[model samples]
Every structure is written in C-alpha cells, then in structure tokens.
Target: MWDLAGTLPLPLGVLDREGSTVIVGLNGLRLLRDGAWKRARAEAGA
Candidate 1:
C-alpha cells in the first residue's frame, strides 16, 4: 500500500491499523479499495 502511494505520489496520514484518522488521495483510495476487494473476493472463493 505504501509502495502504491509512493509511485502515485499520494498524500497519506497514518495513525493506526484503522484508517479513520488517515487521509488519502482519490487515486490512492481507489487503488486501496480495488486491492481490498480483490483480496476479499479471492478469500471468499477460497
């Protein structure tokens, strides 16, 4: 995730495991959401 943000030059704020305190760029959020969705779908299929 950090790597993705780095490549995209996305802004970020890390507070903890939860993202409630985090601030991210639109592209970053989209990428993160897509990654999470893919992971969840794979796990579900497994």
Candidate 2:
C-alpha cells in the first residue's frame, strides 16, 4: 500500500522468503491487479 502521504518520493525495501531483497512499485501492483484490483479497491475504500 502507499504510505507516508503527499508530494516528494517514497523509497522502500523488502526481503523475501529466501532473504532476497527487492523493490516494489505502483505499476507492478497495477499489472498484478489488472484482473480486478480497481473494483476491489473502490469497494474496500467505500
């Protein structure tokens, strides 16, 4: 999820099961949710 509101840029880091670290982005989530994320998020927010 998007954390720390307003302008500027946000940087984040995470580790996986194997201890492999990687970066995440909104575009990735968009593509991952291309099937139904939009409606789901709207409903959740509503």
Candidate 3:
C-alpha cells in the first residue's frame, strides 16, 4: 500500500445520502472496532 500522506480525508456524506442506510449505520462502528482490533492484534504480536 502507498502512504499518500497528502491525500485528503473524505467527508461523512461522501457516500449515499439516501441509499446505503445499513452501511451508513454500521460503517463508523465497524471502522472503530476494526481499528481497535488491529491495534490489539499488533500489540499482541509484538
């Protein structure tokens, strides 16, 4: 994967404003959970 440090982050409304209701509902939670899981796994591995 590339760093792309200069890349700008996408806004929350970047996705569907009406559609993807289910995805919108779970996206943030899933992202946070995955982040925590990744950190936990990385620390455990280290």
- In model 3, the Cα lDDT at residue 16 comes to 39
lDDT of 1 by residue, 1-46 (tens): 7655665333433343236535445446766677788988999999
Residues 1-46, model 2: lDDT tens digits: 2333543333332233223322345445666765677888888999
Arrange candidates by TM-score, descending. Answer: 1, 3, 2
34 Cα displacement, candidate 1 (Å): 0.4
lDDT of each: 0.59, 0.50, 0.64
Q: Model 3, poorest ten-residue lDDT window?
A: 1-10
Candidate 3 residue pairs that clash? none
Q: Which residue runs does candidate 1 get wrong by more than 4 Å?
A: 1-32
* Reference-based TM-score of each model: 0.32, 0.26, 0.30
Candidate 3, 1-46: lDDT as tens digits? 1225634345534443445876777876775777788998999999
Residue 16, model 3: Cα distance from true site in angstroms: 38
Ten residues in a row with the worst lDDT in model 1?
Answer: 8-17
Better of 1 and 2 by TM-score: 1
In candidate 1, which residue pairs clash? none
Looking at model 2, report the run of 10 residues with the lowest lDDT sum.
13-22
The numbered model that scores best in TM-score is 1
